[model samples]
Structures are given as structure tokens and as C-alpha cells.
Target: MTKNISPPEALIYAMVTVSAADRAITTDELNRIGSIVRELPPFRAYTDDWLADAAQDCGKLLRKPHGVENVLDLVKATLTPELYETAYVLCAEVAASDLAVHHEEEKFLALLASNLEMDDLVCAALRRAARARHHQL
Candidate 1:
């Protein structure tokens, strides 16, 4: 039986997948994801333990053929137009949390931006914000 994830869960899974894209999900990335869930208003009702289940579901989806595309489809369906930017921002934060956007992570973000019809300028701004937040200096 296939388990379906809710919109909020989808958002969390998306972040998890991006962090895992580089094949090395750093401690910083996981901590950032956890913080987002714990502190964000949108995720107030979501429990912390659900992160693992969502991540595992995302892994299963990605293992299938055209999994990335499939995941994008899920994202589009789960998120409303107004919330699209929120999704992009969340994904960007995860991608940049480690202070380094790996090639795979960058590719995933680009695809996510395209899928969500996010404006390039907006994406640039979001990326800048994410980088700034994680900047050590």
C-alpha cells in the first residue's frame, strides 16, 4: 500500500529531499529542517517525529523512475499558488543551511523553482536570504 503525505508533510519532505540530494545530508541541514518544523507557524501542528516518516516516503518516491518529477508533481498539487514561494524559501533554506549548495542541491532547487513557476528575481532574493542567514561571517 502506498502512503500519501499531506501538504504540510509534503513541504517537510521536500526539504528533506533537497538536503539529501547531495548524497551527504549534513548535521547543519538536519538541524535547520528540525528548527523550521519546530519554529515555523505553518508547521505548528506538525510533530517533530513526522520528519523521519516524511523523509522515508520521499526516499521511496525518489527511488522510482522519474521520481524527482513525480515529487514535483506532488508538491504542485499539495501547495496552493500563494504558498508556492513559501515552498521555495523552505527548500532554499535547507539547501543553503550547510553554507554550501552542492551541485545536486542546486539542480533540485532550480527544478523546484521551475516547477513552482517562481520568478528568477524572487528565487535569487530567497537564495540570498538563505545564504545570509547561514553566513558565518
Candidate 2:
């Protein structure tokens, strides 16, 4: 079942998914996600407490079945096309944070793209760009 989630909430969820893809969350990944959350335009007015609350909400959802779908839908519905594209780029960044993408990570990113109604070609491009970026890091 789908749940109602705001754009910012969805972005946080996306962050959670990327962070958890390896079955282990790293400090660098967490810090990167925190930075991304803080830089988002929708989160501009968020206080520290508010950001913490959102992070908690995302943490809860991560434990649910098909939770990623719900978050991607929220983001797809709420963000403009350009923003969604940006978010996809951000997802790539998150995936690359660990210096390598696992199979699970690739699947998760593909699923995220599907959830957002992005074309397969676009998803492939995103993956390629992400891998390239990771290699550069």
C-alpha cells in the first residue's frame, strides 16, 4: 500500500535507501545524506529539530516493505521534472559514496527510477554517470 509523503520526506527516504543498500550504513554516507538534506530547497526552512524529525520518519519507513516505492512516488509527484532529475543525480551521488556500487545498490537505483517513471535509458545513463563519479573519487 502507498502512503502519503511529502517531497522532503521522500528525499530523505531515498537517502536512507542508498545508505542501507550495502546492509551497512557508514558515517561518510550518513554525513553525505545529511548534507544533501540540508542543501535541498524544500528543506531550506527546516530547523535542526525538524530535520531530525524527518530523519526519524525516514528511518521508520526504511524498515517497511516496499517503502522505497512510497518515497519515490512522493518525490515524483511533488517535485518538478527538473527537480526529480536532480534528485536522481543525487541518488547517484549517494550510491557512489562507498566507492563502489553493489548489485543490490544497482537494483535499488533501478527500482527508484521505475518508481519515478524515469525511462530505462535515463536510469542507465544515471548509473553510468554515478559509476564514473565514484571512480573519480
Candidate 3:
């Protein structure tokens, strides 16, 4: 049911990568990812099945040695400038989905910011927003 699949799939893959980086994927993380695809403006046109396909594709990529860098490069290449921060924010949201950022997730976030070459201020703001939004209080 994936239609017109393209670079945006990289976005989903990025989220999935974050979810699995700790060697475990939580229900909250999975729900947050699904909600992102279903309700986020950027994904309004994206298909449900595309999420599964993207996640699976990312799993395969991570099985390789340099898959993390490779997948991030694909994301940086595909996302428009406007969407660059959006991708970072989505990753941040997934990172915070479990109520705390794991060490592995922190490393992935740093790597993502480095690869995206995001503005330091923008990255800080997105990180705060994602944490605030997902806070378990």
C-alpha cells in the first residue's frame, strides 16, 4: 500500500533507527512513530504501509557496518531545507518517547545533528520541545 515512495521514507527510517538503537523498541516509541506518520503535517500524505516498509528497510541498513551513516546521508540528501529541522525534531521526539533518552539514543542524536549540519540554536530548541512534549509528568 506504499504509494509514490521517495526520500521521505528516509524520515521514517530515521525514526525507526532511533527506536531500535538501544536494542529494544518500546510500545510508547512505536505509538509515537505511528502517530507521527498519521497526524504530523509532513506525513499527511504518507501511507500507513510505508511506515512498516521504511522500518524494515532501516533494519536491513543497520545490519551493515556503516549503515547508520549511510542512512543519515540518504536523509540529508532527500529532505528539503525546510524539512531538515523537521527530521531532527522527529528524531528527537522518538528519542524522548520512553521518558528518557538512552545513552545510545543520545549518541544517535548527536550523530544526526552532525550529519544534518543543523543550526545549534535550532537543534537545542527542537530538543527542548521534543522532551517537553514527551515528558511523563
Model 2 has an lDDT value of: 0.72
Per-residue CA lDDT of model 1 for 1-137, tens digit only, reads 23566778878868977888888989999999999989998889877667777777888888888888888888888888888888889999999888889999999999999989989999999989988888886
Off by over 4 Å in 1: 1-4
Name the Cα RMSD for model 1: 1.7
lDDT tens digits by residue: candidate 2, 1-137? 35676676667767677767778877767777777777878678667676678767866776788666656666677677766666776777787777877787778787777767788887778777867866752
In candidate 3, which residue pairs clash? none
* Model 3 lDDT per residue over 3-122, tens place: 233656878978988888898999999999999899987777778897887888788888888888878877777777788888888989998988979999888888888888888888
lDDT, model 3, position 107: 86
Superposed on all Cα atoms, the candidates' RMSDs to the truth, in angstroms, are 1.7, 2.6, 3.3
Off by over 4 Å in 3: 1-5
Winner by TM-score:
1
Global fold similarity of model 2 (TM-score):
0.78
